[model samples]
Target chain A: MKSRLRVLRAERGWSQADLAERIGVSRQAVNALETDKHDPSLGLAFRIAAVFDRAVEEIFDNPHRTEGPG
Target chain B: MNPFTTGPASREYQLATAGWFTLYGVILFTVAWAVDGRGLAAPWVYPAAVAPALPIAGFLWTVLRFMDRSDEYVRAVLGKTYVIAVHLTLLLCVAWGFLEVYAGFRHLALFWVFPVFWVAVAVTGRFIRTTR
Candidate 1:
């Protein structure tokens, strides 16, 4: 899944480690999520959203949702 | 330091693994001394032979506990690595079995399977991407 995690983290002046600490995961996990190498689980996505004070959809682009009819 | 190894869960897993492996070595040595040096009799030797396996089970339990306590990405990466390691170990052992039967290869001890699986895990983990 595509994510704006890098952008979001950058805007907040947070390093990968900073964001990872906030989300209770390793920095590598933050990098993986930012690079689209791994998709976060629902719980992790919620946690990330909570950390950023945004909606999950705001961070992650839902490909399935985009494929549906308007 | 690897981020995966920095957490409390990792520390606990490491300690548990060390404890279990140490126990395994001690039990194995004691059993060997009893059976070979002291001429331990039959029936009793059976349980003695099986004693070392308990610590191996404990070692596996530590891995499970570590995975349960890890974050989602670490758990996912480790889960995949273990699956790959299991398949690799199975393939190697099966091929060796066939070779021993048909090609005059020497028989390998079954206890080697545990170490072989860990070797496979190390190799697969080296090549597998844990991060981007």
Candidate 2:
């Protein structure tokens, strides 16, 4: 999943650590989300979206057209 | 406040994980010693090792029992670490079994493997947090 987490966090002048603390996850998880290397779970996605006061769809995007293998 | 011990109802989850750790350690030592010294078949060792699944199930049951309204960052991180370590440990142990049993190689010992895996998990988890 691709996410606008970094952009949203930056708009609020928050460091990755700051955002992570607010959302109750590690800074690396936030960094991974920003880099699109990891996809947050639904609960985490909701938490991130809540922190930015945006809908989950607005923050996260499915970059791939086809789903990968299980 | 430490949610693990004092905050809300999550202390039960913490205690359960600790209990699982104890069970895992005890079962591993007993099974390892029994299978190594005695005349038990190597295949029987598999069933003994699977005993840890009981504790793991108990731990997860506790986690589900007290799903708090607020997230616990520490628990989430530790839980992820535990999961990743378990996966890597299982993979390495299986690979070692195949190499030693099937291919006639017995280079790695259990003592070294256990400590290496424990340290690797800690180092990897810390690296994930500390890297700039």
Candidate 3:
């Protein structure tokens, strides 16, 4: 899944290591997440959201979601 | 500290693995000495031969504990590596067994399986790309 984690971290002026430390994950994990090589589990997603101070959707793109008719 | 491992759990796992291997080496040497140099009896040698397995069990326990303490991503990566390693080891063992039976190849010791599995793990881990 694609994520705006890199952009969000950049906006916050946080290096990958800084963000990884804040989220209690390794820098390599953070790199993998940002590169879309790894997807976060539900619990990890929530933790990432909490660390970013945003909803999970704001950081990770949900490819499964479809637009409903108005 | 293993390059693939990170965080506090990594340190713990490394220490545990070292301890287990150290114990394994000592037990193995002792058993060999008893069986060979000291001429241990048949009945006693059977139980003595199994002594090194205790440290192997400890190593396996350490692996399980490390998995429990690892984060989701590391666990996932390791899970994949193990799966691949298991399959590879099994395939090789089966093929070698056929060769031994049909082609009159020399019989391989069962203890070699553990080392073969570890070799497979090392090979697969290189390609699997775990977090450093």
Candidate 4:
């Protein structure tokens, strides 16, 4: 899964630790999420969305999903 | 709290852990000395022998507090790691049990359980964190 967590966090001018603290997670976790080394669980995706005031789908995308022709 | 866990531990938790272990160690030494030198003649000897368990309880409390202080992502990572650790530990223990029963091997000590579980968790966590 690819995420816009870095973009959203950068827009807020918050460092990884700041975002981690806000989200109640370690900074290492935030780093892992931004680098796509780890994927977030549903509950974590919701938490991240809540932090950014965005829908979960807006933040994370499943690259494996295919789009059908309109 | 007692130098365990990958996540950070609070100062109070660390202090309590250290203090408890120090006390536990002292009590353990005292018990061993009394048993060896003077024998378990006194009524208090039995209670003194088990005093080391108090620190184990304190260590467990610190572990709980450390987990509570960690963020959700860290907790999730650790929770998954714990599951892996449990599975590995269980398999090792079961295999060892079978070996003892079928092959006439010496019985293993119960105290090796936590060490095996934690070691598995540490190794698995490293791999999980590094790999996609």
The DockQ figures for the candidates are 0.46, 0.08, 0.39, 0.39
Deviating ranges (above 4 Å) for candidate 3: A68-70, B1-3, B130-132
- Judging by TM-score, tell me the better candidate of 1 and 4: 1
Give candidate 1 misplaced runs (Cα > 4 Å): A67-70, B1-4, B130-132
Q: Least accurate stretch of 10 residues (summed lDDT) in model 4 chain B?
A: B1-10
Candidate 2: DockQ?
0.08
Highest DockQ against the true fold, candidate: 1
**Candidate 1 structure quality by residue, lDDT tens digits, B1-132:** 243466788889878877987998899999999999999998999999999888877978898999888887778877888899999999999999999999999999998898898789878876665533
Identify the candidate with maximal lDDT: 1
Q: What does the lDDT read for residue B29 in candidate 1?
A: 98
**Candidate 1 CAPRI category:** acceptable
Worst 10 residues of 2 chain B by lDDT: B1-10
User: Where does model 4 exceed 4 Å of error?
Assistant: A10-14, A37-47, A50-53, A62-70, B1-24, B41-46, B130-132
Candidates sorted by lDDT, descending order?
Answer: 1, 3, 4, 2
Alpha-carbon local distance difference test for all models = 0.84, 0.66, 0.83, 0.73
lDDT of 4 by residue, B1-132 (tens): 112343454455557766876876787687788889778766877686667566677767765776687655555665666678889999999999999999998999875775687579667766665223
> Between candidates 1 and 2, which one is better according to lDDT?
1
TM-score for each predicted model, relative to the true structure: 0.89, 0.44, 0.90, 0.68
Evaluate chain B of model 4: give its TM-score.
0.64
Between candidates 1 and 2, which one is better according to TM-score? 1
> Candidate 1: lDDT of B13?
80
Candidate 1 collision pairs? none
lDDT, model 2, position B31: 77
Clashing pairs in 4: A24-B71
